[model samples]
Target: MSVRATTVLTHVTASAPILLFIEENGACNTTYNQPPLLILERYEEEEHLNLVPLNRTKHPLCNYVLTNRWPIDQNWLYVDDEGLHTKSIDREDVSIAFMPVSQIQVELNLHCGSDLRMKRSLSTNGEQNWLGPYDYGANKWILTDSISYNARRTLVNLIVKDINDNSPIFVGLENEPIVVGYPESDIEGFVSPRFLVKVEATDADIGENAAIMYWSTDPRVVVSPNTGDVHVHNTATIEDNYRFTVNATDRRGSGNTGSIDVLVKLLSSEEIVVITVQNSFLDDEDQVLSALNAAVDYDIKMLCASVVTGNIEPTYKRQQSDDLGVSLRLFVYGIKSQEAIKVDRLTSDLSDSNIVTVNIASVLSLQDHLDKLQICPLPGRDTGLLVATIVLAGVVLIITLTVAVCFFLKRKKEHHYDQFSDRNSLASRNDSIKSSKSEILPKINLDELRKSEKKLQERLDAANGSSIAANDMLPVIIEEPSKMTDVAQTPKETLINISAPDPKAPIVIQSIDKLKDSGADSDDDDEFGEKNKVRRKSVVTFNENVEKIIHLEDGLDEESSEPDIEVYKF
Candidate 1:
């Protein structure tokens, strides 16, 4: 079947139906190599069959295929049910395409110099072709096609499917050596998710063909698929001299890729610490420093004792033999102090191990949580202060000595006063004895006592003569009226002669009934009034021994008369 016109009217109005269909045959004449098609019959149910296409035996064949390759040989033919049909060879800009079907499109124009081109095909769409891969001088198509109406004027956007035209290019991946983690913090765990390196690529191809994906062969590292950032997956879990390669693959059909070598190194975690300061306030002249310097190896001893013990307690204050001080030495270096931590001297047991070549850091300056290092003071920095302290201490010493001497003198004076008191007491005792010796005037008069004794004898003789009965004359008791009996008296009056009683005599002591009958007006004494009085023994010889005998003076009451003193024969 063949179409004679571009437009046709059909009686089908409810819906225009596309009635295109293909045909196949076993022995139809194989001529133009064209595909079979079925002849149109009934296309719609509602439309009248008024339109029809007749088999056009006479028609022009327009070129359909386009190619980028230059034509070499030609004997073009089309085969179909009629076997093979010979096609005309009209020279144009080679409108027909080549066999392999290249993606490159070409538009033809003129040649260089005066080489005139042959005006070939007059077809509206035909273009002129010359002798090169591309027509650099072919500027004749634009103005002619738009204004002159001679050349092909059409802009077709052809999408050439990717065919792996380019390999991936790793951007900046020219054998560059990348190191991870700061040298100071070489430990494996320190490298966080922070990007170590970024892998990138550029491809001349467009769209998915140019898109690059990153991949690594090393297990210790991984790369982001979209960002291409290389990262440490696990450093400690991998082996040493650990290295691998990374590939940048495009999304092309072949996955054409470019690669770069990656080197993984476990940077050394150890560092050598070199402590530099402005100066250390160590007493270089101290003998302990000199001796310790000799005893210890040169390398073990640091810049100064103070440098080691800067913020800590001064080494001079450290105990050589003090037990408590030894325990408290570390305490003296409390971390609260803002000064750098240090030690005075290393013990023999720990000298080798504790005072090791440990690293503060490998950086220019050790980072103390981000603060800068403080400079040390100069040696013997307190000389003037020490001198002033010494002067003040001397004044204090002098004052203390003066006070002590004054106290000693005062105590001596007190002791002298005590001695003077003892001497005065001794003098008083001597004077007392001298006064006793001089007191010989006022002697007791014995004549008055003798007269009183005579009177008493007369009264006793008179009373005995009147009251005695001849039969009972032996020391009989007499009861007489009280000398002035103006006062009331109970049981009359009792007079006792108070004569000495013979030790052999059986004496009848009368009871004191009269005293018991007396009223309370009589002077009375407390029951224990004499509790504190000391009792004494006294003896008096009545008429000095008749012969010339000596008698010892005894303690007696001065008021007692000799006659009133009664001596008991017992």
Candidate 2:
């Protein structure tokens, strides 16, 4: 028979003892076999059969706080059962390791250090894995079991806090000791507040750390806290010069502050009196000052003086010429109001020979007058245009005059040529007249004349039947006079004489000496008679031929003892 025991054991420990007893109860009593048997049994507890409490093994997310720009590679927290435990395990049975989650894992892997460190700077409003209130789980440290090859991971949240590490620095103050002038008063003697300068500063920190405030210790100087604009107030007690410091502080406090120096100058108000004089009267500066002092009865302080010469308007007297005189300008100050009035009145008097004029000077007026008072005035657009117009007009006038002269010379030459042509024509006419006179009065031969006379006598004697002697029948020919005396010897009588035997032919007797006497008398009449004397001789010769023809036609037998008369008249 086999004895087998089946019993349920609860709350048993490993390596504990167990007892088994068998009893016979059907035939006889079997109490003698077993007096009490105890067996020693050892058992192993398997990991899968063990139960673990939920509270003992936990996966918790740990949070840690750090500042930006903290020490690198510094241990912030340890991944162990004591400080960063998430599982129930012995320190030697598990391996601790850390890995950054998300994009920060790449950053953590590059650094080989065991401890955690902020490799990069963090900000409140930054786009980094760790922020000012970093709530995202950025890292996970693992507790891996060495025996079971299981891992227990815990999340680590890194919070980056902002610190006030940067101080406020002044900006745009490179010209360190800033100089400002005091405000000038108006005609009512009331000075208005004016802006002096603006101060600026910058900070590197963010949030409340970057805000700045401005302040000044000087009573007269006021600064705007937000805008950093400086101004002056209550200027009645201002000094000639003031040197003070303007401070700039961040919102973090006095530890982060900056300062700069500023200078303020208070100048006394003054009036500028300009005195213009002719250089001929007061060219020297001392002379101008003396004359001004004498004219106004006050000692004048001349700040500056200048003299200009050449082609400038005379400051004293009016003149037409541009080169009037030298202009002397005197910049005078420290004159009383009454003296200024007196100077003005004297200048306006025109009788005052020294000073040209005296008037209040302004910045613009002084600059303008000084520009115009140059020794050589610059030619402006209008001046250039006037010069161009004058030159053009002069050129046009010269051209016109040249053309007129050329036309006149051409007309005069033509008129002279016409006069020469007329003289030539008149000379040609005179020559033609003289040539006709020579041709008309040809030389006669005496022998031919005698022969012709003898023939005519023979014919007349045959016709009349009267025997006439040769000497009596032939007509006489008178010689022409060669000299003026020969012409005067001729008598003033009938010019022609002829006697015929026939009653039908009237007897004609004319004296040739009378024609010569008439010609001689006409020659003594005027100056032109001398010129007509030659023409008269031509007429005398022509009449001689006419007498011969008459004697031949009428068979004249009677003849006068005087030479046959021949008359020539022009």
TM-score, one value per model: 0.25, 0.23
For residues 181-245, write the lDDT of model 1, one tens digit per residue: 22223332421224445667776555566777878777767888778787766543544444567
- The worst-scoring run of ten residues by lDDT in candidate 1 lies at 327-336
Which ten residues in a row are the worst by lDDT in model 2? 101-110
- Write down the RMSD of all candidates, one decimal each: 29.0, 33.7
Candidate 2: regions farther than 4 A off: 1-159, 173-175, 183-193, 252-255, 266-570
- Over 64-167, each residue of candidate 2 has an lDDT whose tens digit, in order, gives 22222211222432233223212221111111111121111101111112322442233323533342333333223211111111112222222222345667
Give the lDDT of residue 516 in candidate 1.
30
Which stretches in model 1 have alpha-carbon errors above 4 Å?
Answer: 1-148, 151-160, 176-193, 234-241, 252-254, 265-570
Q: lDDT of all the models against the reference?
A: 0.37, 0.43
lDDT measured at residue 262 in model 2 versus the true structure, 0 to 100: 74
Shift in Å, residue 36, candidate 2: 65
